[model samples]
Target: MNLVPLDLDRDLELLHAWVTHPRSHFWGLQGADPQRVRAEYERIAADPHHHAWLGLDDDGTPLFLAETYDPAHSELAEHYPVRPGDLGMHVLVAPPTRQRSGVTSAVMRAVMDFCFAQPGVDRVVVEPDVRNEAIARKNAEVGFVEERHVTLRDKVARLSFCTRTAYAMSAPHLQPAAIAYAHRRLIAKAIAEFSHERLIEPIAEGTGRYRVGDLAFTARRYALNHWVVDADSLTGPLDALDFIAGLRETLGIPEKLLGTYLEEISATLAGTAWKVTHRRESAAELVHADFQTIEAAMTEGHPGFVANNGRIGFGLQDHEAFAPEAGRPVRLRWVAVRKDESLFVTAGDEREHYLAELGEPTLARYERQLRGHGLDPDDYRYLPVHPWQWEHKVTVTFAPDVARRSIVPLDEGPDRYRAQQSIRTFFNVDRPERHYVKTAIAVQNMGFLRGLSPKYMQATPPINEWVRQLVDGDEELRACGFGVLRELASIGYTGDAYHRTGTPGAYTKMLAALWRESPVPRLAAGERLATMASLLHRDRDGNALVSALIAASGRSAAEWVAAYFRAYLRPIVHCLLRHDLAFMPHGENLILVLENHVPRRVFMKDIGEEVAVMNDQPLPAEVERIRIDVTDEIKELALFTDVFDGFLRHLAGILASDGVLPEREFWALAGDCVRAHAKDHPELTGRLDLLRPTFKHSCLNRLQLRNTLQMVDLTDQAGSLIFAGELENPIAVFG
Candidate 1:
């Protein structure tokens, strides 16, 4: 059984049916209308003490309702002594289903499992109608001991309690079917992505089956244009580490890369296990949740990458506190760095602007802390550091700075932040309108050691300003509703001639921070924000987030697709054609501004690290560093490779798989968006033809497979690219 948060609005009708059924006389609602049901549940939803949930079977059918409440404030509290960790709950199984042996017991056990899973929940208390012998017996099966008789609002109930130990001893382990299902899905992803990258070859066995590693691995055709690895072929229970080990030789993995890659795979599996054990919200409910809540609740990381959630440096406890998937709030550790040894840059009025944003009282407190250490406030600046970095990397790796009094730890700031999808960047949850702080840490994830380069920080602000000015000056970009989230300021302190693990260029990136303009202040009235990654989000029930947004828009799926392409794709193509510019338009780098669930515009970010200019065109000397010389033949790859192959391919795949928009139609719409931009710019007619925008398939997995520790040589980014020949461009068919 799957236990999930109850979405009252979506499940109101079904709940009303269950509550008013003839067998549900104890529920006390026999003649209720839709309005009555809404009013009643809305009250419960508003109360901080009470919460409801729905349980579903493997097939996604709702089978029961479970309500949990704070027993300290509950009706049962008046009757029984409430312990510190006690929780009150009520359960209602759907009617008319045969009460077979172990059926009700199974549901009760699942409910108990969910309750105990919560932090600090040591015991669960329940009160069922005394006449309900069946429910009393079900509770006993799950280790609930009868405590006493209690009078609830409208019924006499048999009070029972189950301690955490009793529940753990009596409850069943996660069924083998569930474990097998998770393993099959993960294995399928590994095989499909590895095959697509041309790292491993799968032998077709005809009739929709394929074998890898001399038939040691078998895959069967599955939905969503992918295959499912058969769990039965494995000699024992499925283990991701063992499975990868078996395929290493066949995939031609080197010794070093293979070991690190296995570490990443292990981390990813651990994260998946935690999610499977704790997730309690259905896709439909998640789709309707508030924007930031949805961002934190996302289960999948990158759809294409196998070890996307590696989070190599994080310990198990750190993962819980800092990982975005954990959805926990973090308080960043602040430090004071000596200005004589640090670098600082700002875009706008630095003192007045920042002081106003971060209240004067806060700034004064930070400065006073510096004076307390006998350091002049004039010689120092504040720096925000990740808590985990302070504990692991900073305290140990940057010990010299600490010893020399160059870096002094300060008290934690008052604001609370949530780690965004990118582990280093944080969104200001305490004050939603504040700028996001992107900090530096030495952690290896997704093919790179994710650290902010001190030199890179120097050019970030100006590059963002240059891009912002370009967008502001272009009539086409304005017409297409393009905007930019600028990196307004940056600060860094690097130790001279530093080296860790004897790798060159890795040491100088140890300490740095930047503040990027938040999209919140720029949002127009009636417009809400969501990450572009939502387009690729598929819930556990196989419903796509984009599809849900389209439904909410009340527009036909095709209309929504056209609007998205116009807002997103057209701006990207125009930038490439007119300015020889491109951005890392990957899902995480762009934020979609939605008005009534219809995408209106997009804000581009990650400019310094990911944006590039691919021609010899003259630019301001200060910003000329953004330019990268590329062969004229592949310059258009700025668009075809970055936007199309990198981002649109996966989005189109998701939409097509869900039947929201056919695969052919999705590419056709993209082609139309590009052609429309080309037609609007007659001056660039010759340039467009020379830059025939067909994509070569760049193998992202190959980069990791070759060097999981540091996938790309940062100094030679373009030269480090690995490609698996070419794919027939999906949009080429349109031309």
Candidate 2:
């Protein structure tokens, strides 16, 4: 492709046709005549800082239009600080006469190349209309980082920038060396996690040397049967697909699910490749970064599941548009659900409070839309929908309802959100105080189809209210500054087809949303929020974020670990011993509020789906679904398997590998926290044993390997747990 200076008289006809097309509505010239189109370009031609160009194919045929200007002299200068070498750009591809793939992307690359080839250009700037989701995604594909929305005279625009380095890092082709490196790392993790689950027992050749099939690697076995494998020492094929296929029988992967499992492994490898090739910050930089920055920088997904990022329904474009690592701002799709078919529940807030979250303008606009449809706004409730879900599932599966106006599709919400690491949940980046909106998308990820059950949605807010009261009443929990982020409101639309069948399958759970309290309002002075998962994040260079936090805190590694235990682990133990309650306290389920680079307290979330009440305590009828009858052994595994083995074991390996803290010392600090808690509550001491010599080994990957669709029945979690044998408790040695 080549760029030629646009001719005023000759290009007028072509520019008019391009801008007047419906596809170019964002250009704001949809009904322009020939005279208007010519006058606009004539104005640009007269400006010293603005220029227009026509992109031509090698055969000298016009394919697209491009514009360039200096941001220092443009309207953008009023919105953001203008750097010395900031060059603003705009591109519009002509409506295609034939279907073509990669044409738009090629045009984008050529435009970027043309801008950088100029004498003084170091970065490219764009202010596409905020409603143009397509261009925003394409911009991200070429490394544009969405900064924020800027309101202009014509429309609200997303101000984004792309540096030369960022463009280079987002090159379409993956580096061969990077792909090899990613494969080696993933293979090592697979071996470690699979062996830890006792699926493929490695033959012990010598101390620290083991062989799985023909692949030989060195590893050290730690407490909880954890395998810390050496990525550099693996001697066999580094292909994850071939490795999984070879061990299919040993891993007990069913023949029918083998292909799906392999696809997940490939996707995981691709995600890793993207991370390594991108411009990732160092651990020290991330330690001082903001919450969302730390969230997007996470490379590891679950730490235990090998195929953690399956995301089966997401195509490549979906990954770029919606994935957390992409760091692109998203605007949720809104729809009106008929009040009779939908369930809306709230903890204590009224409907007006939830409606006010949309702000007055959006709320008024939505109500107007419902009236336009000849439907009463009072008979409907507005619900947030994941953009992907709106496009893929709702439009297709609920076509009859939409046609009958039972589910009326509305425009995108005004506020921009960022996808959290959990993928389905979104954080309000535009308005930090707004509640987090969690929508259900029918995508298969991790061990189940990621959807919110309407049956569970009915009880979500009440369960959150119960848990909030419990946390508020506990003196020990309050002393540690521990709290729960309540899920205040929820709305779920049950389809007529599935509701009549009375089966709460994935289909019935597809259209539901919940509003949870944001952590932003809970921040104290000098305190910021970071996901607890950030503690386990390692940069591409192998430096641990936890190590960086310790360095920043001006404290010894042991001191920092002790503080972390006090803020995180002690409250978890208190909840279990004093309340007979257990939460799935994985790193992703908790948020750490840090003051001066130290964890001052924690706020637990995902309360409704994860929290379990083990004892047969009397509970409110509305919140009785959380109650579960389990044996003492299963209740003990709540700490042994969920907390120690699932979360802390990975943290221990990260710290040990970084040489910041030894493994033994880490568990000793944890044991000290537990003993202190036990001593404070003598009546609860014998109810559960924290220092048992061994605990049942609950295999996570085994659960997925056995059944990828639904790993375990949520209703019978205790009975569905897959266990191998037993693991020696690291805390037992400290006792």
For model 1, where is the 10-residue window of minimal lDDT? 221-230
Model 1, stretches more than 4 Å misplaced?
A: 1-181, 205-209, 213-238, 495-504, 688-695
Q: Native-vs-model 1 lDDT?
A: 0.76
Tens digit per residue, CA lDDT, model 1, 1-735: 788888976898899999889888777788888789778888888989999899896448898988889999877778978899998888888885542323455578668878888889999998888998878877876689998887878888889999988876652323344455456556767877776666777777666567765344555432222334544453333666777888787665687678888888877766665555445455565556655766776666776788887888887667768888666778888888888778788866656654754679888987888888888888887788888878887788788788777888886777889998898999989888898999887778877777887666888898889899999999999998899999989888764437323355666776888999888888778888888887877655566788888888899988999999999988988888898887878888889888888889999989877877888877877687778887754666666667776677777766765768877788788778877877788888767542343456676777777788887876567888887766556667644
Report every candidate's CA lDDT: 0.76, 0.89
TM-score of each: 0.77, 0.79
Worst 10 residues of 2 by lDDT: 169-178
Number of the top candidate by lDDT? Answer: 2
Candidate 2, 341: how far from true, in Å?
A: 1.3
Superposed model 2: Cα runs more than 4 Å off:
1-175, 205-207
What tens digits encode model 2's per-residue C-alpha lDDT throughout 141-231? 8899999999988999999999988987775525566678778889999999998998888899998999987789999877777888998
